[model samples]
Target: MTAEFTKRDYSLVGLDSKLAEEKGLANAEWYASEIPRKRMKELIQRRNGPAIRDTAIWFILLIASGTAGYMLWGSWWAILPFMIYGVLYGSASDSRWHECSHRTAFRTKWMNDVVYEIASFMVMRESVPWRWSHTRHHTDTIIVGRDPEIPAPRPPDLLGIAMSLFSLKTGPGEILKVLLHCTGRLTAAEETYIPGEEQHKVYRNARIWVLIHALVIAVAIGSGSILPLMYIGLPSFYGAWEQLLCGLTQHIGLAEDVLDHRLNCRTVYMNPISRFLYWEMNYHVEHHMFPMVPYHNLAKLHEELKHDMPVPYSGFWEVYREIIPALFRQVKDPRYYVKRQLPGSARPAMPGPAAAMMTE
Candidate 1:
């Protein structure tokens, strides 16, 4: 028989949610490789040193670059420093937001919260709502109707994806959401994941963000220059490309509604600089497989679990080579996806109740 492809509904309010529940995909138990309890404990150990050091360097570079950009504002030289500043503000903050949100970045809970709040603001993500949204993401992964973070949905908006490289599409929409949240309102989809008790925090965070942006705009008006925004508000848009590149690789074109992370996630080898900037999230499969493990320990975790997982893509180029074409084909054939093949040496995917219930 020809390969079967069904038109899928991605909306939280749609039939996919009921179908997912019936098929045992919503809040399903996922397949995880067997690891000794002791070994798993060692990998999950939390520490403050690495995150503290990395965060310090990140802030220092952001400050230095912002200063240089400000000083060079009248000349073409401003471009270089601003670009550097934007990457730190927009891109680096994303990974920091992610790690800290998991509360795995720092040994101290307060430190993680502090950095999460700061990074959330920098990346224009409201802390409370996004935390819950991400919680659902981890629980349901790429399952249709359950995951709100699916980057390139089927019949993908190619132009929107291209514009998102610079945050042109998502940034404005996120800002609008923040503004709406400031009015103590949330969309129905957000309400699905965000608890009523936490809505207040979302509203408060939105107000703070709105106030900060307003203050920056006021400064720009008072000085008759956009320098304040360049250093603060605008970099989120300009410097978002790197994060987009990294984020898309996590699950784009991968299998959905599966219990196995190896089928749905990617692990790409990255250079030291990229590794540091991304906080080692390049080990996407490892992260999905065991999010409790801290970022510093993901490489070790990858080594331990690699035998059970699909072979990783060699690097970003390897990922893009597969992803770009997959995306192109998906435009015409929404049912098409990249199927990962495991090596002969790889262990079988862990069986779960959900596995038997998987829909075709």
Candidate 2:
């Protein structure tokens, strides 16, 4: 934020609240520009190849990690770095699972499903539930009540109010939450699920996965002497931190909480640093606009969309730059706080062409 945001900086929020005033809900598309069909294609993933790659890499890490764990077992100190690598490896591949869930991991759908389920069961806590819920998020990005990732209001009670004001260390706080959730001492279900999915098949799938998780936990525990904790716990912690930083640094504060393009999401173009570390997710705005676009091609699509797309806003690092502030900030309700007009903020965008209807 101290980077001294500019007119271009404000574009990160694709739609502005004013558009809602210009056009009613049903015909909102008039308010925004369509993301080009050609551009969308560029972002789509050829996931099968990558899915296979992810599985192979992760499998190797897991096996090599166990050997490393046994060799370093007695030296509690040595176990520390191995734990870090295990989690980082798992965490990195976690996004690979995201690709699989969308069935973008492989050219063949069946292959994707088989591979995705295996990976999902290993690292994704609520695999099926996550798939269904996340699909909804893509379908309806920031739609206040609809999006699974909606930020809950700061609790109204006095203690809740007091706690909201205090800040915790960002990295460690995220790590702890993951650890606690993994142990079952706390349920992150609320952090993930909401009111509508109770009757869905995803609930059934989630239950089965949970049972499977019990087995994984048991195996992890049998390793004893905190070895299981190191193998599973450390990775879970690292993965959680990655997820938290990714979300917080990207979204933090921008537009209102509408699912429409205007307030929902934004994209970032790439620099070498972002491209390498984020794997092209730096084009956050473009990805939000065109969800089918794979992370690998997001940067390219962003460049193309720049001229034709009448974005509500065009800003970068909105989430990444303010990681610490976002962790402590309550980011809902007041919606967008704007001091000027820019990309996405210029108007509330109406919906674009309906995405190709997804089928299982």
Candidate 3:
């Protein structure tokens, strides 16, 4: 049950990184489901309409809920409005930041940039560092040393995962990272993925974020109330549960170091509300395989690819039913993973030490 032999270096600049490259796991071409060129083109085609409409609705909800929360302050009724506001501010923004980072959310480049910046602040991810970090994530997927974004590295920090549910762990760390960046410094690991040319942008963004946070603190001090922070600086921590809930299902229990996303990523059906907030990222395998497909078109793409892919989890409940236990098992057995089984029409799961067939 011990994980001693399976302990891995999860660092981007560590020995395992070189190992991954030597093993051809670094930026390697991956297995992808086949689709006709015409259909693939249609799926990758971006349109401004869906993103524009969704963004409008998102802003309207934020304004409405935030106004209600502000008006109802000093009363017990305020909690309800603020809860809605927090979800919109913290939870929904996570997906917005993600999609806009890919520039697939909106057809217009400037439009995506604007939302990307706004959502980045809301999610407390410094725009520049995270953009490069996420690029590494897509390139490496779940490869232990190469992927900078592996959420649940083996022998997973169970307490840390619990703290992240409310952003208790990640929020302060991100803020501290920004503070470090504001001093015109970059961590050695950050420098590995983020180019030297982009380093200045990271420092500049950190300073802006620190200034905005300082302004929020100043407003609360001047008013002799914490109401300002409730609207801005605090929601990212208080409303982070939804973000973690949707995000954990992406690859927590899946095989690592596999070339096929079908073996590592998850595709779960979600309710309409969760889908909206997560921006259809529950179709995570599809997104990882064909990142150019827009959020609005993931469902259609899922349909087209399902015949050639492993069976997707039916819903969040189904996904977690397996993930929760698998994580607990991994705490003692780091080699354990939920190996996916491909359909008869599809190719076998990629070869790896973690390879096995998981039945539905």
lDDT of 1 by residue, 63-181 (tens): 89999998899999999999999989999999999999999999999999999999998888889988998999999888888898888889889999999988998999899999999
What's the lDDT for all of these models?
0.89, 0.47, 0.91
Q: Give the count of colliding residue pairs in each prediction.
A: 0, 37, 0
User: TM-score for each prediction?
Assistant: 0.96, 0.62, 0.96
Position 38, candidate 3: lDDT: 98
- For 1-360, candidate 2 gives per-residue lDDT tens digits of 223222211111224223322333222332334566665665574655654664676567667777776677788766665654555444544565566676654678887677667655445445555565676556545433334544322211233322322212232443343345445432334433434544344446555555654666787768665656555444554444443444333344544334345333545443553343344555566666666666556666766665544342233454345333433443321222321123652344443332111000
Mind giving the per-residue lDDT tens digits that candidate 3 earns over 127-223? 9999999999999899878998999988888899999988998888898899999999998889899998989999999999999999999999999
Best model number under lDDT:
3
Assess the local accuracy of residue 92 in candidate 3 as a C-alpha lDDT between 0 and 100.
96
List clashing residue pairs in candidate 3.
none
Candidates 2 and 3 compared by TM-score, better number: 3
**Model 3 TM-score relative to the real fold:** 0.96
Cα lDDT over the full model 3: 0.91
